[model samples]
Structure formats: C-alpha cells, structure tokens
Target chain A: DVKVTQSSRYLVKRTGEKVFLECVQDMDHENMFWYRQDPGLGLRLIYFSYDVKMKEKGDIPEGYSVSREKKERFSLILESASTNQTSMYLCASSGRGLLDTEAFFGQGTRLTVV
Target chain B: TQLLEQSPQFLSIQEGENLTVYCNSSSVFSSLQWYRQEPGEGPVLLVTVVTGGEVKKLKRLTFQFGDARKDSSLHITAAQPGDTGLYLCAGHSSGTYKYIFGTGTRLKVLA
Candidate 1:
C-alpha cells in the first residue's frame, strides 16, 4: 500500500524555536504538499513541491517553508514557532497526474507552540 | 479568502438518517476530491470526481460533481455511527496547481 509517513504525531515547541516536520512517502510520487488544518478553516495549503529541489508557496505560506532534497522525503519548516502556528500539520503525496490520481496523506502532526 | 466553501459546517443526525453536504466554488476545477478524517487523524481520500455532472457511489455514500465542475456534493444513505467524521472537499487551483480544501463539514452520527 502507498504510505505517507510523518516523522511525528505530536510536537511541542517553544516560541521562537525553529521547528522541523519531516515526511516520507513510499510511493515516490512527484508531488508533495504540506497543509495546516484548524477548526472551521479546514486544510490550508502552506507549501508544495513538484520535484526534488523545487518548492512553491501556497495560499498561506507566510510563516512556513519547505524542503524537498530527495524523491521520497519532504520537510516543513517553521522559521520561528509562534503560538498562532499551533495547528495540525499534514503531509500528502500524489503521483504525477493531477486529474486522475489521489493524494495520500500522512497521519498528521499536532503541534503546540507555547 | 477561501476558494472553496462548504455549507453546513456541522451536522448531527441519528443512525439510519440521510444527509447531504455541499461544496461550492466559483472557480472551475479540473477535478475534485472528497476526504474523511477521523479524530486525531489526517484526511483519507474517499472519492475523486473528474468529469462534470458525474456521480459515483461507494456502497452507502454517493458523490456528485456539478455540471460546471465548480461544485460537488456528498450524500449518505442511512448513516451509521461508524460514518462520523470530518468531511472535506479539495480542488486544484487553476494557476497554482495546488489543492485547496474547503472549510469542511463535521458530521456526527448518533446511535
């Protein structure tokens, strides 16, 4: 089965700390994405990568960054964690095709910044 | 600004009841996907609709894509307690090619 594995299921970070959320996919999909989900806000895209060493900002990418140095690995970074950045972060992977393919998501990381 | 909007943010119904959730957007989508997320878990793909005015059924659940490809709906027949979860709709943006999710509909099926 295709799997997207998140490095952490839960995390606690101090304010102003640099945070890293890692994800790995077994499917070797060309597309990977990071999204933060909040109540009533659903899942908002933060960043996505179409290939290794390529990243694109999403709608809400102000405080977040992404790294895709390898084919199966994608990482989300918070430059300086803040209380407002506390949210459930999810990682997803999809095969090359966007129209017919489905994106498989990781279990998610619930981050709490204090 | 939300590109996709889902109506009835929350729904609660007894077992065996039917419910329909709507996802609306003004921007056209090449394809739309529906996902279900349980507590403490990420969303799981339930179905993907690519053609306009298309309908797909998965046992007790039915999905419909709008004729304009700008909207979609999910209908559940005889909902069960096991079907309780947060339902989300996602569609790729025209220029960005990134999927944007709707506000979501939280459904609680009481037995």
Candidate 2:
C-alpha cells in the first residue's frame, strides 16, 4: 500500500509565528499537493509541486509557500501564522498522469492559531 | 467560482435508509471522483467516473457521470452506521493540474 505521512496531527501556534508542515510519500509520485479543508469550503488547494524543486501556486497560496527538495518529500510553510489561517491541512500525492489517476492522501494536520 | 457544488450540506438518517448525493458543474471535466472522509482522517477515494454517461457500482453504492460530463451522482442502496462521513466530489480542472473539490456533504447514519 502507498503511504503518505504528515509530520504533525495537531498543532497550536501563536499569532505571527512561523509554521512548517511536512509530507512524505513513499510511492515516488511526481505530484504533491497541499490543501486547507474548512467546514463549508471543503478542500482548497494552497500549493502543488510537480517535480523536485518546482512549485506552483494554487487558488489560496497567499499566506503559504512550498518546498520540494526531493521527489518524496514536500513541505508547506506558513510565513506568519494568523488566527484565520487555522484549519485542517491535508497532503496528497499522485503519479504523473492525467485526471484518471487517484491521489493518495495523508492524515491531515489540524492547526490552530491562537 | 465554485467549480463544483454538492447539494444537501447535511443528512441524518436511520440505518437501512437510502440516499443520493448530487454533484453538479457547468464546466466539462475529463473525470470526476468521489471521496468519503471520516473524522480525524483524510478523505478516501470511493469512486471515479471518467466517461460521460458512465455508471459504476461498488457493492451497494452506485455512481453515475452525466452524459455531458458536467454532473455526477452517488446513490447508496442501504446506509449503515459505517457510512457516516463527509462525501466530496472533485474534478480535474481543464487544461491544468489543479483539482476543484465540491463543498462536502456530511452524512450521519444512526443505528
């Protein structure tokens, strides 16, 4: 079975603090994504990486940035956390295919900005 | 713009009942996917409908993609307590690698 691991399951940070969310996939997938899931909004993509060291901004990438140092790992960075940035963050990985392939997801990290 | 919209934000029903969730869109998609998410866990892939007017079944669950490829539906023949979760529909954005997910439907099946 393919596995996507998230660094933290729960986190609490003060306002204006920097935060890091890490995701690692063992499937050697070529695509990795970061999304924030809210109650009514579902999952909104924050960022996605198609290759190592290459990243692209998604719809809601204003307060977040991403880094993909290796093919197996992708990281989401919050430059400055705010109260409104608190949400359940999800990490997913997929192969280099069109829309037909399914994306494997990691257990989400619920972040709370105090 | 919300590319996809799911109807009935919340549903609570007794076990053995039947239900249907709809996912509609104005834009055409190469494929549409359905996922079920449990509390404290990531969303799990339930089914994917690619061809227009396609119908697929997984046991008691039935999925159909509209002929125009702009809509989809999921039907549960008999709901169980284990079926309680958030159901989401996602589609690959046209000419892009991004996926647009629908606002989820939260379902609760009571025993």
Candidate 3:
C-alpha cells in the first residue's frame, strides 16, 4: 500500500515563530501537495510540487511556502506563524499524469498558533 | 476560479436510512471524485466519475455524474454507522492537474 507520513500529529507554536511541517511519501510519486482544512471552508490548497525543486502556489499560499528537495519528501514552511494560521494541515501525493488520478494522503498535522 | 458547491452541510439519520449528497458546479470538469474522511485521518477516495452521465456503485454507495459534467451526486442506501464521516466532492478541470474541492457534507449515522 502507498504510505504518506507526516512529521508531527500535533504542534503548538507562538506567534512570529517559524514552523516547519514535513511530509514523506513511500511511493515514488512525482506530485506532492499541501492543504489546510478548516471546519466550513473545506480543504484549501496552499502549495504543490509537480517535481523535485519545482513548486507552484495554490489558492492560499500567502503565509506558506514549500520545499521539495527529494522526490519522496516535501516540506511546508510557515515563515511567521500567526494565530489565524492555526489549522489542520494535510499532505498528499499522486502519480505524474494529466488524467484524473487518486491522491494518497497522510494523517493530518493539527497546528495551533498562540 | 473553478468552484464546487455541496449541499446539506450536515446530516444526521438513524441506521438503515437513505440519504443523498449533492455536488454542483457551473464549470465543466474532466473528472469528479468523492471522498470520505474520518477524524484524525486523511480523506480516502471512494469513487471517481469521468464520463458524463456515468454511474458507479460500490456496494451500498452509488455515485453519479451529470450529463454536462458540471455536477455529481452520491447516494447511500441503508446507511450504517460505518458510513458516518465527512464526504467531499472534488472536480478536476480539463488540461489541469489541480483539483478544486467542495465544501464537505458531514454525515452522522446513529444506531
């Protein structure tokens, strides 16, 4: 089975602190994505990487940035954490194709900013 | 921007009841997908409908895509407690790899 692993299940950070969320996929998928899930807004994409070292901004990418140094690993970075930035973060990976492919996701990381 | 809208933000019903969740969009899509997510875990793919007016079934769950490829629906027959979760619909536009997910429907099935 394909596996997507998140570095932290729960995290708490103070305002103005820098935070890092890590995601690793066991399968050699070429696409990785970062999204923030809220109660009523659903999952909003923050950033996505189609290949190593290549990243694209999603709808809600203002406070977030991404790094994809290796094919299996993708990282989400919060330049400066704020109270409003607290939310459940999800990581997903999918195969390289134009066709609609199913994405495999990791257990989400719930972040709380104080 | 492409958007998918889901109706019935929350639904509660007794076991053995039937229910339907609707996902509507104004823009055409290449494919649409349904997912169920449990607490503390990521959303799991249930079905993907590609062709217009297509219907797919997985056991008691039925998924249908509109003929214009702009809308979809998911119907559950004899829903059980195991079916309780957040249901999300996502649409993928033609020539784009990105998916726009709809606001989910939270279903609670009680015994």
Best by DockQ: 3
Candidate 1 ranges with C-alpha deviation above 4 Å:
A98-100, B93-96
Report the lDDT tens digits of candidate 1 across residue range B1-111: 538899789999999999999999998988889999999999999999988999999999999999999999999999999999999999865344477688899999999
For each candidate, give the TM-score of chain B: 0.95, 0.96, 0.98
Worst 10 residues of 2 chain A by lDDT: A95-104
Off by over 4 Å in 3: A98-100
lDDT of 2 by residue, B21-52 (tens): 99999988888889999998999899888899
> In candidate 3, what are the lDDT values of residues A1-114, reduced to their tens digit?
889999999999999999999999998999899999988889999999999999999989998889999999999999999999999999999887665367778999999999
Tens-digit lDDT string for candidate 3 (B8-62): 9999999999999999999998889899999978898899899999999999999
Model 2 bad stretches (over 4 Å): A98-100, B93-95
Displacement of the residue B75 alpha carbon in candidate 2, Å:
0.2
**Docking quality level of the chain pair in candidate 3:** medium
Error of 2 at B82 (Å): 0.5
Scored by Cα lDDT, where does model 1 land?
0.91
Lowest-scoring 10 consecutive residues by lDDT in candidate 1 chain A? A95-104
Q: Candidate 1's residue-wise lDDT over A17-79, tens digit each?
A: 999999999987989999998886778789999899999988789988889999999999999
DockQ scores of the candidates: 0.62, 0.65, 0.67
